[model samples]
Target: MTTPDKPLIMLVGMGDLSARVLTLLLGHDATSRVVLAGRDAETARRRGNLALFTAANLGRHADIRSVGLDLRNVAATAETLARVRPDIIFMGASLQSWRVITQLPKPVFDELDEAQLGPWLPMHLTLNHLLMRAVRDSGTGARVVNAAFPDAVGPVLDKVGLAPTVGIGNVANIVPALTHGAAHLLGAPVEEVELRLVAQHYFSHYVPRFGDAGEGAYHLDVRVAGAPAAVDHHRLFAQLDNRLKRLGGIDGQLLTASSAVRVLHGMAADSGVRAHTPAPGGLPGGYPVRIRRDGAELDLPEGLTVERAVRINEDCQRADGIERIDDDATVHFTERESAVMNRLLGYDCTSVKLGDCPHWADELARKYGEFAARFDT
Candidate 1:
């Protein structure tokens, strides 16, 4: 429950990302109250207790609560939201984890990887759409930080005035890499370097793997000692590709969870924090943002207007396997992604209407499960 002195922070999913976020919150002693709500109450309680125990042993403690929540049931979720009246909600639920695709054989994984992250829109979109509606209906007015594929999901929800406050990870993950690389090239300390990056999910995923943006577009500005610096983008990325070594698979969630904690603290603080976030205010991609208690606003470069920044991300959508998202919330998949889904899973979804996301999500999950079963033996 919320109190006048301490704010209630709600974690809506019990997934790995949410667990990591919970642990970080406890370790940082960022919140006094936290509620872990998910589909399984027992699992949420277990995780919450373990987190509290770990934090207690480490000399940090919090009032942790857990409850079963079926986000698919909007009325129930809304009731819980109203009851808890949390100040900040971190939602990370999805029909299926993105890692599920990577579990396939290497050849099959590479084949699906060609489609990028767009073809699996339904799996990521439905729960968020439902949660937003529940948020609106509950009228809690809590700041929401979504951890799903916010690049596309955020914009689609924006069409209906249901976008979350801002998205975490994605572009944020790139900013740290760029900041460290720039500091190394400038022979400055990392703390003295400030980076403003505007990129989408595709570029974020691509640059780490291949060191370059491939065909995706982005805007990057670097400053050292509070003065603008002229660093070569090519050399910066080269350094990242050569020097930065990251753990693969679920191990990487630490970076993402850390990013989420940063955004959460920024939003909870009275003053604004200069940060990078994906899908702020339902934009096409990520941007340099100023996060405060009020909300997130674009803190773009001097020459970049919001319109131009959006256009850059809009053009790069195809790189993420999305052709476009219509004003009415209809999502058009790129030809490559559509063809790959059709051929591999026998699920022919070229476009998806926002209202039909749940059905599409179910169908896609079923087909993908059957397809993955073939390789089990």
Candidate 2:
């Protein structure tokens, strides 16, 4: 139950990312009441108990509970939302995990990697679409933080006025690398370094692997001790690629969970806080945002107008396999990505209509599963 003193937070998935976020929230003593909701009631209960036990051992206390929620059933989910009436909702559920692609053989994985993350949009978009509709129907004004492929998912949902308040991870995962690299370059403390970055998900992966933004368009401005500083972008990125150690697979989710905690705290604080996040106000990609009690808004760098920043991300979205999101929330895929999906899974989807997301998601999952099974041996 929510009270005036402490806010209620709802974690909508019992996956690794959500579990990590729950632990961090409890460890930070950020909230009093947290409801872990998912499809599997037993899993949710076990995860909730583990979180509670971990927090208790760490000398932290919170009201942790669990509930079974099938997001595909909008009415039921809405009923749950109306009953819980949380202050904030962090949605991490999806039809399929992004890591499913990694399960393929290395050669196959490399081939599909060229398609980028956009071809897998159906898996990430469907649940978020359902959840947002539930939120609207339930008449809850809870601020939503979507963890699904927000760089593209956020914009697609925004076409129908169902966009999340903001999104976590993605571009946010790049900020820390930039901050550390800049601090080392300037010989300054990390706390004294501030940066405003306008980017999308592509650069987050590309910069770390290739030591450059590649074809992705982005803007970065670094300030040391509150003053604009001149730093070498090439050198900074190279160091990030060469010197920084980034965990791969599930372990890397810690960076994303930390980003969500920061945004959650900012949203609850009266004075608000500034942080880098993806899909603020359902924009094309990520930007520095000012998160307040009410919501989040883009805090773009000086001289960078909203139009220019959006254009930059819009252009980069193509490199990520998304051609564009139509005004009606239909998502179009690049020719290469469409062909790749057809070749690999025999699941052809050049475009997807918002209303047909559930059908497409199911088909994609089934086809991909069969495809992966053939190579399992």
Candidate 3:
């Protein structure tokens, strides 16, 4: 039984991950409903960890339900939408995309029609298309959150005119992590160190992997008291940034899952406080998200840096390839992503291009699909 007045969140993936998110959401309030969705509801239900999220948390009125949904099929997705009429929709389907894109022969050079990497782009686009339709039909202003790479997906979704209300993870998660580290390096409270960062998807995704992200190459500035001061983190983060840069061959599922959990915490607490988050509605950029208590709609704060970050986020994400970060000499994206895209989508690298992508768009999508198809658990 629902609390009647409780907020309803419809989740696309009902695994331990989604269960974790639901558990976090419940911590904030008992008057909440969570509808776990997937192709195999029974499997999701039997996954004791996830099922226990609702069974133990809500007592009698704890609203947790399982439903069958094949998001790849637009109509089926729309059908799920019609039935739930939820207050919020969190799309983690792209997590599967991440898994898929990671598995290909990396930069697949040869492009074949069936083996094309770009075909998978349609998977995301179509799912979003159907979801948007469902939102429109449901007549609910349910905020939509994309739980995947924002830089690429955000822009792609924006282009298709179905950008989500916002994107989770990406640079948003990095901000806090870096901020925390900065505070320690500066020998100040965790809240004292502030990051006025202008970055793209690669900065967030590959920063830790490369172990030496941007370094002097990655542009960043730290402030101690509103204005810029010579903080030790300025140099320390640079070193750590490089150390944390994305590594070519490394397991990232755990990292990705941790980031997902952070996203859940930030979004679930939106009703209670002001916090940081990546831009919503797939704005193709970064922005300070002030989640409106009334409907959880995020907005930019008043300031030059915040505005500029938002602008930079959009520009880098929208460019033809490797967009200039606010006219600074810093590289916003790399050919690596493009090559990955091309191999993933099986598309001609030349035909597919993004401002920051190192390879073709279609190729990446196909690779993304192939990577996702093989996940056993």
C-alpha lDDT score of every prediction, in listed order: 0.88, 0.88, 0.52
lDDT of 2 by residue, 1-377 (tens): 56644678899988899988898888655564789999998999999899898889988888988889999899999999999898899998988988778778889988877788888999999999999999999998888999999899899999999999899998889899999999999999999999999998988877887788888889998998889999999999898678985876788888999998888777755336888888988998899988876667788878999999999999888888899999999999999878888998898999999999889999999998888898977
Model 2 spans > 4 angstroms off: none
| TM-score head-to-head 1 vs 3, winner | 1
Candidate 2: clashing pairs of residues: none
Q: Write the per-residue lDDT of candidate 1 for residues 21-103, one digit (tens) a residue.
A: 99988765446478999999999999999999998898887899998899999999999998888898999899998888888
Q: After superposition, how far is residue 203 of candidate 2 from its true place, in Å?
A: 1.1
Taking all chains together, each candidate's TM-score versus the true structure is 0.97, 0.96, 0.69
RMSD of 1: 1.4
Model 3: lDDT equals 0.52
**Which portions of model 1 miss their true places by more than 4 Å?**
1-5
